[model samples]
Target: MGTRRPNALQWVWYTFGGKLPAHLSEWVLHDVTCRTWVLRHFLRALTQLAPFCVVVLLLPGPLHIRLSSIVLGLLVGLFYSASAMVETNEHRLIKHGYPPGIGRETRAIYRDLRRTARDEARRRRGWE
Candidate 1:
């Protein structure tokens, strides 16, 4: 199936840690890598927070309150973007042709490789 762009509500759900259905996950992963996924979320958060930042600065408020609002907006934006990490990783895995739940297997394989390399190094040092 062609990838359907997520609507606002779906985006909100995804931002809040909702899992995409498998079919959609594959389609989304086809379009986005880990870097683009992160940039997309960051841009989205900035887009949402920009207006709030402007309003906070423009509104008639004490200096401290305005500063606090700006800070709070930044914190909230970062939190919202970071909350999508799970979905981002899922998409990244699919993009790389790995099925869901392969992370542990991949890590184990990586660890084995590292161990073998280390053992080979030790053996070579012993010979020398």
Candidate 2:
């Protein structure tokens, strides 16, 4: 829905800006491949918008937080959530490589990471 293929520089910027490491580029790539950009946007928007809505609804004062704030919050939250989700999913994928049950996958990925740093190291060395 937005841009595609965020470079490493972009990732660094996002990370520095407090993102949890969700790679929008990779999510976009996967979504585009699956022809699910609309769904991806919708979900990401909903996730991001949820918090803003809560803030707006729960505001103790009159609903005068500025339309700009609301809109900006929505946009920023969406991007942040999308990025976070991408990062979390990538971590899972790196650890588990796609299997059933997220809990199982998460544990597997964690266990693998603990035991397989050498493998990753070897791969990195090969590229050097």
Candidate 3:
């Protein structure tokens, strides 16, 4: 398997903390280390919360009450998601046979390179 993508079922499993097949390891690494990983994390968190939110919405309630419930649920859910983001991604990578911290390490290297390039450009323009 040349870095196969997860099927919808596998993706749902993954979104709920399950592991993908070994051949999907490359995809997992990209997911955890991508430039949009934070957004991906937030989206995953939201997806995890969607079912409960739907239940809450479906229950008989005033518009304001339902809206407030959704808001509070999302805020708390996203707060926890953001707080554990780094560790979660690291764990995901580890579960997929990546060395511990590799995701963070890779992102850090990319970030450093981008910063270096930006600084070089700034210096070239006499802006710093």
Number of colliding residue pairs in each model = 0, 3, 0
C-alpha lDDT (0 to 100) for residue 105 of candidate 2:
47
Model 3, 58-87: lDDT tens digits are 999698999899999999999999999999
**Model 2: how far residue 8 lies from native, Å:** 34
- Winner on TM-score (2 vs 3): 3
Indicate the worst ten consecutive residues by lDDT in candidate 2.
12-21
Candidate 2 versus the native: TM-score?
0.35
Query: Candidate 3 — number of clashing residue pairs?
Result: 0
Scored by lDDT, the top model is 3
- What is candidate 2's lDDT per residue for 49-125, written digit by digit as tens? 66667777676765666555677777787667667654544443444234335434444565688568878888899
**Lowest-lDDT window of 10 residues in candidate 1?**
26-35
Candidate 2 wrong stretches, greater than 4 Å: 1-33, 81-89, 99-128
lDDT of 1 by residue, 1-128 (tens): 37476677865655444655555665455334432545766765676677789988999979899999899879987796689655665555655457885544544566688799999999999999
TM-score of each model, in listed order:
0.41, 0.35, 0.86
Q: Select the stronger candidate by lDDT from 2 and 3.
A: 3
